[model samples]
Target chain A: DTAVSQTPKYLVTQMGNDKSIKCEQNLGHDTMYWYKQDSKKFLKIMFSYNNKELIINETVPNRFSPKSPDKAHLNLHINSLELGDSAVYFCASSQDWGQQGTQYFGPGTRLLVL
Target chain B: QQQVKQSPQSLIVQKGGISIINCAYENTAFDYFPWYQQFPGKGPALLIAIRPDVSEKKEGRFTISFNKSAKQFSLHIMDSQPGDSATYFCAASGRTGANNLFFGTGTRLTVIP
Candidate 1:
């Protein structure tokens, strides 16, 4: 069984279109994270939720919002996407927050805004 | 600020050769360091990790060498095989409340048999 899974492996939309990516983890982890990997292969953390509570919010713009309905699912919604929003979004989950836990990542969703 | 810096953006190695990737961190607060391996069209997977208290760790053909004083760490793959070809990333994280990871650019390793 895949520990972490993501829907819509690829997404292509117009500059002003809005879209959402879904993520789910069966590891029974308490913390889930959303990460963005740019074309340069630089991975940056966008948001993190611990047991459905917002914990980490990076310098990402308000156009991106993360919602966790429960401990097993975390979804990302992009509003009025722009060209800069083109990248790979990965979902990860861990048992807890901190150095003691190891995160497991999903396959990832490639987003393209034209 | 880029907390973790990795070297040799890309590397090529022959079969049975050793592949080394180096990384340095600027944040002293970072207590955990991990190396992740990623294949095309897939998310990265944790290969190995090390803590500040340890100097070296080895798992099968993969090893992690850490230098606490220098705030540096390296991943060494012994007897590299073509199957090991992938992009590797180095990351660091502190014990702060957020515990968010700061990742390095990435190193693409290609082992030609």
Candidate 2:
């Protein structure tokens, strides 16, 4: 069984469009996160959710938003996609962000905006 | 702050040679350190991890060397082979229950035959 899974493995969209990526984890983890990996392969955290509650919000722009319908699912929606919005989006889950635990990651979704 | 720092953006090692990747963290609260491996077109997966209390941990060909006072840790892969070539990430996090990770810029390893 996949520990964590992400949908829309590859997304291609035009500028000014809106789209979303879906993620799910089967490990019964209480916390989930969204990370962005740029063209250069540098990964950065965008948002975090624990037990369906928003916990960590980085300096991401307003266009990027995360919604967790439940503890097992966290979805990301990007509004008015821009040229710089192209990157791989990764969904991860750990037992908690502060407590020590190994995070399980999903097969990232590669997004391209033109 | 980028809590975790990793060195040698990329590395190349010959077969049967030892491959080393180093990492450092500033927060003393980070009690768990883990190394993750990622193949091209895949998500990073946990390989092995160490707690601050242990100086070293070994599992098969992978080992973790940790120094609490220095707040430094490293991954050592012995008998590296082509199959072992991948992007490696070092991460740190500490919580009584949940999983929030502070990641380091990854290290790409190329094991040559």
Q: Each candidate's TM vs. the true structure?
A: 0.97, 0.93
DockQ of each: 0.75, 0.61
User: How well is each residue in B1-113 modelled by candidate 1, as lDDT tens digits?
Assistant: 78899989999999999999999998898999989999999999999999989899999999999999998999999999999999999999989865587899999999999
Which candidate comes out best when scored by DockQ? 1
lDDT (CA) per prediction: 0.92, 0.89
Give the poorly placed runs of model 2, Cα more than 4 Å off.
A96-98, B96-98
**What is the overall TM-score of model 1 with all chains considered together?**
0.97
RMSD of each: 1.1, 1.8
Clashing pairs in 1: none
Chain B alone, TM-score of each model?
0.98, 0.96
